[model samples]
Target chain A: MSVDTASAATTRAIVTDAAGSSSRARRGGQRHPATSFAGIALRTPYWVLTAGLALIFLYPLIWTAISSVSPLAGTNQVDGWGFGNYATLANYQAGI
Target chain B: MTATLHPPASSPAPPEARGARRPARRRRGRRTHGALAGWLYAAPTALFVLLLFVLPLLLVLQMSGSDWPLLSGNQGPNFPENYQVAVSNRFFMDSVIFTLKYTVLTTVILLALSLGLAMLVQESSRWKGLLRTSILIPSALGLASASLLFYVIYSPIAGPFADLMASWGFTFLGTPDGALWSTIFLIVWRYAGFYMLLMLVGLQGIPDDVYEAARIDGASRWQTFRDVTLPLLRPTLALTTVLCVTGSLLAFEQFYILTKGGPDNSTITIVQLIYSVAFQGPNDLGVAGALSVIVLLALVVINIAQIRAFGKKAED
Candidate 1:
């Protein structure tokens, strides 16, 4: 019973400490709410732009990956997907 | 008993005094030993550099002054004649011009794209890791491998976008303009990430308080970037610019694999010209050696100029 009571008291202390810290953080945050909002507003567009550019930069690799598996790759006609292109590597002395 | 038997002048020193004196002497000896060991450890690398680099450089210089043939041996010192022949070659002159043009274009595009990407990645809040990794993935690919991949992409028949591009009436690697742009695009794709990493290091080195101060002063984004970021990033920019310029000047592999100096040798670089001269038919190894010497001298001069320019700016 004493051990249980001790653990319960510690948990209460932790909860109160967390609440106290959060309240302090909230007070600090409220002091410059407008600046924080403006900062986010300024950064949002750049974040979107970053994501778009990343996609563009990665497009070639993505295309290469998809083409490696597609049956139409290196051929004029598009067809069902197969591993024939990869399997053909076994025929070459260099082994790809 | 010994202390009592011996006179004052002949008596041995006390144990504590001897102990202190011994350590001082041992420490001095150890310092010398440590320095010797350090040099010993560095000797192999120094010897390797001397044998591989210095020896070859001297040999090349000697060969440049002689009429070194492809099939036979050197025919004694020819001196300025080999250099004169290299200078007089129209094809060599054309290759040099093309290399300079390519270097300027590649350096400008790579630096701009890398700086822009670095800034974007640095400012990003949520997807910074993902964006950086995706952009940097291409840099992990070997240059030759990337060139081969791009070769397939630039193909008229085998490319994934072949039909789509054909419908648009545009060929990527068929003509001179198309080929040059395609090669530039490939290089930018391959190296932008690597350079971006350099610029990002420069960016992250900047303290947050600097930006905070700029913000407090109500500086616009462009103003802050110009006044603060660019000045601070000068050293990194200098390094990347020099690397890009030198690498572009010596470009050969991509052009060799993709175009073979194609659409009329328009894309041939200085190194490619040297390779052809030394190895190809009508092989002139002496002229090639001279050309190599000229190139090495030019590179050294350019690097020195760049370093001096950056060093001056850093002092100011």
Candidate 2:
């Protein structure tokens, strides 16, 4: 009986603490309302510029990787999907 | 016995003591934070070098021992076969000799040109800044782009460079002997500015007072330059020469784009030959990896020898 009562009392205290903490958080957020929008409103342009430049610089490397594995490397075939192109390197030492 | 910690109330720790403790505690907090920040700042660079540079190098060294291609998954152990194959190859021998010859020639030319440019620009003239800027512009061009530029410049049918050479009763880059000189000229023009900057830094470090005293003592321009300038510039000269030699030894892009190892393969560098063996002709990356290891070992030995030679000069 004592154990049951103690457990119920502990649960009540936890609920009360959580409710109080959340109320405090909401009040704090309301106090400095501009802080909430500061990140998105101030930093959006920089984020966009960085993303654009990253894409521009990375395009060539992406193209090279795609070209290295492209199926159009062979005589007639336009599309290749498997590792056949990589296998052709085995016939590399046929001559000097 | 269960011990519970508690502060004594009889003679309380002083308020100033508590205040002092706050700063100590703050210092402890800052030390941990600062150490963490240092690690955080260095982590990206460390991880990048570890992953991209170090790992690939180790992988290449491992690949050099085995007869493995780019796609080799699992192969029987024929350890050291690649090394043997590369060692026995006559082309590898020729490429090494060619590379050494080119390195020596290019280093000599680059050092001379850079030193001359440095001397010219070191004068306290009004056009010094303009001259420096003009000289350095060539260095800003990418090696591959510069090679393409030279390819047109060296072409006989379409180049005024060829006409200018012919007017002087000589060809520049049309033949093998001419092509070697032409390539060296291109390299000297490209790198002279960068080395000039290094030389300029060394020249600036010489005290104005020393030059004043030398002038006051009626020292001639030649004597002042020969005695004071050269001795002080020894370290810089040695460093620049090594850089020029190493960079020239690793020559690839300029030759590949300009000469394509032409005129009976007289201009073929070690790296160009390695590229031909690995990718262009045979696609034998195993032999290429072995050759890379050999080249790396050779560079290490050369660097050590160079340091020993110039280090003695510095001591003197």
Best by lDDT: 1
DockQ for all models, in order? 0.15, 0.01
Summing lDDT over every window of 10 consecutive residues in candidate 1 chain B, give the lowest-scoring window: B120-129
Top candidate, metric TM-score: 1
Residue B144, candidate 1: C-alpha displacement in angstroms: 0.8
DockQ of 2: 0.01
In the range B58-118, model 2's lDDT, one tens digit per residue, is 8778768767665663254456898898888777777788889889889988898788778
Candidate 1 falls in which docking quality class? incorrect
Q: After superposition on all CA atoms, what RMSD does each candidate show versus the true structure?
A: 10.1, 25.2
TM-score of chain A, predicted model 2, versus the true chain A, to 2 decimals: 0.45
The lDDT per prediction is: 0.85, 0.75
CA lDDT, candidate 1, residue B270: 88
Quote the lDDT for B134 in model 1.
88
Q: What lDDT is reached at residue B234 by model 1?
A: 92
Q: Judge candidate 1 against the unseen true structure and give its global Cα lDDT, from 0 to 1.
A: 0.85
lDDT of 1 by residue, B232-265 (tens): 8998999998999899989999899888898887
